[model samples]
Target: MDPQSALPAQLVRLAQEESFSPQRVLDAVHAALAPRTGVRRAEVLAHERGRLVVVARAGEAGPVPGACATFTLRHGGAELGLLHLHGGDPSTVDRAVGAAAGHHLAVALRDVTTAREQAELHRVTDAVRRLFEEGVRAVSVEAAGRLLVAVAADVLGTERAAVMLVAPDTRVTHVLGVGLPEELEQRLAASLLGRLARDSPAWQRAALTGGPDVVDAGGGPPGRPGGGVHSHRLRSKLKLPLMSAEGLVGTAVCGDVTRSRTWTPADRVLARRLALQGAVVVDNARLRELEQAHLRQLEHRAFHDQLTGLPNRAALLGALGDALDPVTGDGGVALLLIDLDGFKRVNDTLGHHSGDVLLQQVAVRLRELLPAGATGARLGGDELAVALAGPAADLAADLARAVHARLGEPYVIEGRTVRTGASVGIARAPRDATDTTGLLRAADEAMYRAKRAGDGPRTAR
Candidate 1:
């Protein structure tokens, strides 16, 4: 095609191209100008991170044979960089073509920059989504909070990230951190709290209005009065509130300590996203914890004596059953049932409260006498039960002696001193009876026999 006819078309095509790229536009400019202006080379340099970076260049750049022209690439009235044309002069055609190419390059560079930023934002959004999913999947509050801080640290590219949960009394609980020492993390939390008053702007915004607060101390000297001491070595700080429908539950803190950092809009957005998801995870974990605690309490109440805090008859039977399971019963098992002696007289004289205290004391002595692989439980008023993994004989004798010694010593209930003795009976699995019910019955019968015969202890037949 003739150069004159092609020039207008080339310029028009460059103008109309939707897929704008810095290098593609530079190449097209060189092709169009080399033919018309006899330009041997063209180069586009863009300013990046305080320096000019060569973005695209076309044709060999040795030396210009004629006049060379350089034009600044401007976008939105600000100079982006320089566009240079070699072997060129300011003839009306050269100037017009160079200016037009410069304009295209400027617009294309801006488009590519924006596209890059948008792509990055999408990636960050995806990552934040995954972080929330992991937090939600975590089985415990500690695990969830750790995941939150770790993810925040990685995403923010900060030296330290931490989570602080506030209690109703304004005290902090469960302070956790990533990339920081436990002691230092604790200190950081303490220091931050010391600076944060209930009425402070950060607290008010986060707890009341649900806004993020940031403090950036750009790589400059510390402005606070105490210099290195009060600054806590932190140059930049970002705070996001962990909010729920009930209000603020906690705060997430991101800090840059090694160097100062300018908080970008993108960084702020990331902080907010993390806090929003983290709050839900934290709340869920806490609620689960409360539920678990409630369940444990119910189980305790169902299978334990409220007065003595010992396993009740039901729990004792369940334990005996477990010990006598066919797979594990080879070890053999022993059951001891004990009844307090002369306990009715103490109750009749001193009152039921004193009886209750003496029962509690008897329970404690039984617990002290129990060895490893043995469990102590309360059968009911004035009666106790013991289950041991090994065979009885010597073990049962030792336990009976210990209980007699401890119970015979004395009891202090509501500042009153009393005395009592325990009648213990022994039953053995496979020897006396292998099942829970049979073992309990044998032990009970032996205990009664001991009491009636005035014997210190007795064994089942």
Candidate 2:
């Protein structure tokens, strides 16, 4: 039970606990001193913020002399603090116990300080991860920026936070945040970040070099320009360059009222991690938007004919089925089939290109001539069809006549005027045939009947 022997063991135990507060260190020191010989009470007093503060006191006895041990927790070879003991008789063993306890206490306090720093680093890392995950839900750049600012404020222990993004071409900075002071926000939006976006050598250097940098209030580093450039009167600042594979994206700046807030190596590491995650989220959102747009275009193309930009065969069939189901419950459906009589002659005389133009022109005219309830389709080659209700044969005849007249007009195809006519066939549902297949067969037979009738239109009963 030698005090010196027990001292190292106690210090090791204290180090393992990972408690680094001043109060915890003092408590450990008092506990170590309590079991030593001739020691009634032990107290530790240290200078904190230029004032003597009692960090730890133990034992039910009175206070000891303040000058017993001499140590200051200041910089540059300064002693840590004082350890006072009240007891009966002074001996070599008693003095050894006090010295040993003091030594162990100092070591314990240093370990505690290191542990606190590590714990703070872990906390900030976790927070940044959460922020990045939450940012994934952001639908726009402004929302993402606001999330970044909120995360920064929580991690850095700042009263307010703001995020600024530099426009690529305009070189203008935009403020995106949730809780920002009015004065700082206005100044940053109007001058500070905007000026940096406009022309700050430091910002430009960091952006171009693709690295991180820091600056303090009152223009801590020289070489930066004045006026709007020096608008931010921050006590300290930390700037990180945002980058992607293509190039630098932008810069992330954090400021606070703490003097030149010296960044730890851990802080820099965490900041870089956050910036990379933010970049990924933004990139993913953009990719999703592009994919949605591409899918819409493909859907539109799938439902329409590429050449005529009208409903194609498949769409026409689907429309026919839908139209027949309701009208079939009553009388039946009606179909009109039209074949361009001399379209092949035009293709042979002009060319396939001119033929395609003539077909498109024919489609337009047919669409205009058809009734409101009629659906039209280009069924390969020069064949076209229109479908309507069963009781509309007279109306169908009127449409067929109009279509024949329209087809007879001269078509200016690729600067060459060509004339064409159409042979029409009409078939009525329930009267000609009941099912869709039979009705289409009847219409096709009637169409050839009209063509054989020598340029006159015909209808099948």
**Per-residue accuracy of model 2 over 1-461 as CA lDDT, tens digit each:** 75445665666566667564445555555555555444565566664423455766766555554324333343225555665556633343445554555565665445544565678678767876787678778766566666776776677665445556655542645565434557756755665454445365655676666665655444465334432223444566666666655445455666665454555566666667767765555555445656767887797687667777666667667666765675444345678888998989988988898889988999898878877667788877888888875445448777877887888889887677899889999887767886778778888898899888855667885
Model 1 accuracy (lDDT, Cα): 0.76
Q: What is the lDDT for 317 in model 2?
A: 70
Predicted candidate 1 versus true structure: per-residue lDDT over 253-334, tens digit per residue: 7777788677777777778888888888888887877788899999999999999999999998888888899986547888
lDDT of 2: 0.65
- TM-scores for every predicted model: 0.81, 0.49
Candidate 1 regions with alpha-carbon error over 4 angstroms: 1-20, 27-103, 189-202, 217-232, 328-330, 390-394
Error of 1 at 290 (Å): 1.0
